[model samples]
Target chain A: MTNDASPNTQPTYYQEVERKGYSRRDFIGFVTMMTAFMGLEKSAIGQVAKALETKPRIPVIWLHFQECTCCSESFIRSSHPIVADILLDKISLDYSETLMAASGFQAEEAMKNTMTKYKGEYILCVEGSVPTGADGVYCMIGGKTSMQILEEAAAGAKAVIAWGSCASNGCVQSAKPNPTKATPIHKLLKANVPLIKVPGCPPIGEVMAGVIVHLVTFGKIPELDRVGRPKAFYSKRVHDSCYRRPFYDAGLFVETFDDENAKKGYCLYKVGCKGPSTYNACGVMKWNNGTSYPIQSGHPCIGCSEENYWDNGRLYERASAFAGFGIEANADTLGKVALAATGVAVAAHAVATNVRKKKLIFELEKEGKQSEQELKS
Target chain B: MANKYLHIHRLRRVYVWELPVRFYHWLNALVIIALIATGFYIANPLAIQSQHEASGQYTMGWIRYIHFAAAYLFFFNFLFRLYWGFVGNKYANWKQFLPISKKFFKEMWYVFRMDIMMLKGKEHMSIGHNAMAGFIYFLTFIAFLVQCLTGFGLYAPMSTWWLPKLFTWVPAVFGGDILTRQIHHWSMWFFILFAVIHVYLVFYHDYVEGRGEISSMGGGWKFIEEEVFERNHHQTPNPEN
Candidate 1:
């Protein structure tokens, strides 16, 4: 690993934020919000502020493989444009297909420069899965397979951040019957670097910023849950903080998308809201600068953040009918049929037992009467 | 008149199920029934519309509360039974449930033939659980463990308690929460099937064998024929037969 910039050579994050015309108050506010989002106590705000003022901008290589580029769209459209701009600039994003202005050989040259310049210091942020099907011909960028590109980029990274569900849990590309054999970064990366998964269809923009800011502030990855998701935003379920949870507690649910209960803002559990099971920051953080989330907009959560949510069941089903029980058999239906069959079996068995018992009793009485008659003779 | 012809003095009373075993039985039966009813309701709650304030109604909350409460009872009750399997009387010993010997399998086959296949075979009698019934109960205990794991695993996110947190690995092993919940719900059905057959056999055996089998669970005593008891009393009691 080689470092091109000395500690004194590069401008710190605070200096860059000031250079970008953000007032000192704006910088502190953004830092405070990010620190809170990372689940740090208010007392640690000064420590984070000091770290950001002293640390140089970390070099980052943002890669795009087989994806819809929605993560980039969401990132650039972050509700607070300054938050997006400062964080993106603070990380010194060297190359991104969707956002970078370079094209053709120039873009490849820039990526190569960062990979060699920073060596083990640069962070590798992958935004999509790597397709390995048919020798990775399904997705090719610049004549190299996604697997080939990912391996090269990850070989020298300090840490890896899987930006969206596609990069984290293989979102829709790796759904059942995945034609491309799309593999998430964790499974495909040969590097043993620390990996963080921010899994959502398109993760909330502020959360993405928060993850980056936490890394810049702490000089390491945030504490992660068992599945490697940052525990701050991925610990609690959407249902745990949902405003409509009272409706669920009261047993009031919207039966359909366009019903009176829907108008009344009832719970969406019946219409297949996976909020109770899915873990994400959508409920508390909301989207688009805390305006509203999908559940708030009267649409059921599709459990986009959870692994294998696509194969769980129909989007509108309350419970998932797992494989091997057959497509038509959910737990309740299977249970009902099994109970019905047990009832029939028990009834038939009872009849047989009674018949056998009566015949045996009759034989015993006949022997008793014959023994009495023989005693009389 | 037929009552006089049948000898009433041919049987001797034997203490079988201990007080703790009977207590565990009835408590377990009650808790399981509560869990199944409330569990199904939680999984598929019927629409209970309220024209009043949402805060005024707590139908689903109460049901969930009852379900979780019963689940705790079910878990601890199962643990108590597991402990009792080691310390309880011979009739309730853990070894009785394990099919460890050739004789155990032979008696299990005899029971299946007479009770299930309805073949006229030599009567299978025991002062305690028959081998076939005991082994099935053993399997049911395993199901109990699964239910506890999955139940707590699903509840872990809502809870910050350490006990439930310990079971977070359960869902991870099963893949995810949806699959974990599916298994938890499926175990409810297994208990349902177990209950139907268990109740049917208790009454069936009591009537056919002329022993107080059903009442034995209630009063902790069973009437064993004197000759059969005497023959087996000298040897280590083979509860299998």
Candidate 2:
């Protein structure tokens, strides 16, 4: 129905997936699922389907640098089996070091062709940080520095998407006294392209899909926060939608991993849940087809989405960074020490005042008696 | 000794602290203490293993409720003091807080030298707050306002109240919640430190000056020598006094 009206060279995402043996029914079901879970209206399913059926696939140049490649793993491990195929078809993914079968010359050639052909039209998806130390030799792919690769790739792109915490804000590599000096994408390359940060240790699989879907469907980046995270996903703290939030409000918390409270599904605040401070869709979107996230499995959020989360220290410490109790001593410890010191000072001062008062009273009595005797004399 | 001193000095009762000032002073003290207790709890709650449902306990909610309620009282009480400074007794005047006057600087220097530097026989005398104390209080007031802006700014996201919503721009102005919470939490310590010093200074002044300085806040009255009263009258003679 669409071949006559559509472009000749490129097949639509629907046609591409259909060629890969997926039924039109599977395509519509995927759209309907995306609409339901991606916080979109029922009408969005039709629009999403129409866009997939009609529009040409978006060209994506996925570049890897200094990362664990967990973002790529998470993206491919999306709950829906069809999402991978749909994603593969819809994104027209030119090159990814980890995902693609092509290697050596063919991989390099494909990336070069996409850069020259698509130029300003393709999306530049960055999955890791770039090490700027020693002329960016810390990370090299096929004898080319990540800095050079990123610059060449980012120089001609419509928008740059930082795929994970590593890409958005250098994960462990950029922690305190970073030897490699791995800097995030936004810092390394300063181009005239819109940048979106999907910042988690590895962002939720569907959220990645949602971002791509938003760009493909809307033809523009989704509404971004001040920090460039998509507002639709990063708008609320994980604690807001958490199941045990009522327990938090009520001050019931799991004292330890093996406690009765933990068994009872109490709030994980005391066990150092960073849910209140962390902004991510993990709670709402969940993981592995909404089966469970970290908190649901009784593990405290490590605040992997936040900048410098690794440097923040200890995922299981109770006090938030706001509480001033993460690294050394929490605020309670500091305040208790200060209060105890204040108490000791007050006690000491009281004793000193009492001693001084006793001396003054004694002298006053002695002077009074002496004055009385003198008056009598 | 009382008779002899009274006969020698012709001691007069000078009504320096007005009822409104005294009321505000004690209320502020009480509220600040309550805020500190609840604030620390809000920052980090005690691990009380109550044998009840989450809905039944409502412990953190109560702690937060007490915090927000006391914060409101502290805010309004501060506002009242600000208003009273404009139109209340001369001693409660905002002009006294500002060290703009040459006399203010002179008193501040004298107090600093005599009290802080432990200078003997420096002869520190003030029927009301000296410029040094007043200046510190002015700074404390500014800090209190910042606490309100930041506390409500953080609350704005959590609360449905229009009052807290008014301060929503504070985080945006200050960058975000991390800094705002730090400022808010740190200000509590400021008040605590101020309280300790304030109480100590009052006791110290009472002991050194041999005056009813401690009772002055409670009774709105201070006993001074007739000469000192006359000198003060000559300086700031309010008809009410």
Highest-lDDT candidate: 1
Candidate 2, B1-25: lDDT as tens digits: 5445323344688788999999999
lDDT of 1 by residue, A1-377 (tens): 11356435677888888888889898888878877888889998998889889998788889998789888878876766666676674447788887777899988888998888778888899999988899999989999998999999999998999999999989898998999898888998888889999898899888888888888888899999888899999988899989999999999999888989999999999999999888899999998888999999999999888887888777887877746888877877877888899999989988877787676656455545756876999
Per-candidate TM-scores read 0.92, 0.84
Per-model DockQ: 0.48, 0.32
10 residues in a row with least lDDT, candidate 2 chain A? A1-10
Please write out the lDDT profile of model 1 over residues B35-127, one tens digit for every residue. Answer: 999888888899776679899999899999999999899999999999999999988889888999888887788788777887876563567
Candidate 2 has a DockQ of 0.32
Residue B183 shift from truth in candidate 2, angstroms: 5.6
- Global lDDT for candidate 1? 0.84
